[model samples]
Target: MAAISEALTLSAGALEVVLAPAIGGSVGAMRWHGIDLMRRLSDDDRDAGNVLGVAMFPMVPYANRIAGNEFDFEGRRWQVLPNNPPERFNVHGSGWKQSWTVARSNAGAATLALEVTGGAEPYSYRAEQAFAVSEKGLSVTMTLTNTGPVAMPFGFGLHPWFDRDRDVTLQFSARRFHLEEPEGVSGDPITLPPELDFAKGGSLPGGWRNNDYGGWTGEAIIRYPSRGAGLRIVADPVFKHLMLYADPTKPCFCLEPQTNASGAFNRGRWNDPDEGVIVLAPGASAAGAVSFAPFALTFPAA
Candidate 1:
């Protein structure tokens, strides 16, 4: 077997992106004007199993937690192990922990591939990731093809760990929200509360929040007041759910563009488009892209 190399670097104009496909296809680093836009990776991150050390990683076949670690589809039940510790349920699918092979690469673009077989995980699919950078920004396209013998549920998302600052602001459109239960499972849908609303883009709150927002308008903007820089986030319509994870005392947090709700697997509402879930027949495929563009943010004098 040909193994993945240690690292691959790509750049265009003022933007640069480093990838470590060998380490679970995670992004090792992303920068703008030599300043990191995503969290920087460390030596521990280079280890294949340390997903938290990654700047960004893909959630495939399905995204987020599945209640009780099991789901039913087409009259069959599938069980997934607890992928994360201190959490009894399986979180995010198996891809982030699996190594990916580089299919192609260049100065400003690259493509990586992972072939996941059944039995090893719930879904057997061929997943691919394409990264391209332009003066405009960095764009990533992720695709997953059902290669198993039966039909199954599918979802995808890009989990990017943005560096948090004291004066960071965020703005996005989401008509509804899925509040999580105590066990980290989504309880029910509700209107956006005052604490959860960011339609006008405000500073990240002083509390912890981990919820999935629906009815996304397909765009978001994040600005760092101190750094006087910002990033524009845009994703294809396949990604209708936006997940924002902010902790009161964390140096970094996540802004994820995902295809479905947090616990779409156990909801059994696969036919509801608003839930963002999709059913793929054998050999069928689904994909979408997420882009990040950095721009100058002019802040007035104190």
Candidate 2:
């Protein structure tokens, strides 16, 4: 494993981004005109290298949870231990907990890479995250390549935490919703209920909302009315699903863009278009980019 002792910074125009390469290739903070676009990672968390406190982090090899911490592929059974303890399942993947090396950096962009071999996990791969900032906003491109000897199922995504402003509103389109099962695992896909639907746009749910929206259109808008700004997320077509986590108890919420559905591996929906799980062969790679563009909102006189 490579070590990156300090966090890298990228700045352009009014946008500034802090990348914590050592902390799971996570973003420490992102600000546009001094207004936080996401939940800012505290200085204490940055010094301690706490990934859970990061504003955003990469999810490579896979995303979300694996039922029973095990799955079968290619006619063979593979098992993995619970990565996130007390949850009873492997949440996210090894990438978010492992250190990444700074591959390249400049004034407005930096790339961090990580290499992993099957240890307690059953997959080996190389992942890279390219972070860049511009006058508009920030962009992150994540790429994952299988380095193992056999074909295996792979997935990747980005988990970003945003401040749940009192008047925050979210908008996106999806074909259906994945029901939430016990332990927060993804259940069956069903008709998106009216309460969970955000087709036209709506505010965050007052109750718990940990579910996945399948058949995502790869675009979303998040408005922070109190801040007088909004963010637009545009992702590559490869990202077919989006996960929304809005626990009313927390001050922040998460909107994740992922290539695979939650529990896709457990369901073995390899050929299913809705699952979005990629079967990568040895030395194969999958890459995608997600861009966040921020704009100021104009309001009428009170």
Please list the residue runs of candidate 2 whose C-alpha ends up more than 4 Å from where it truly belongs after superposition.
Answer: 1-3
lDDT string, candidate 2, 1-302, tens digits: 32487888899998889888888889988888899999999989888888989999999889999999899887898997787777899888889998889998999999899999997778899999988888978989999999999999999999999998889999999988998999999987998878788989999999999999999999999999899889999999999999999999999999999999998989997989789999999999999999999999889999
Index of the highest-lDDT prediction:
2
lDDT of each: 0.87, 0.91
TM-score of each prediction = 0.96, 0.97
Pairs of colliding residues, candidate 2: none
Among these predictions, the greatest TM-score belongs to 2
Candidate 1: C-alpha lDDT: 0.87
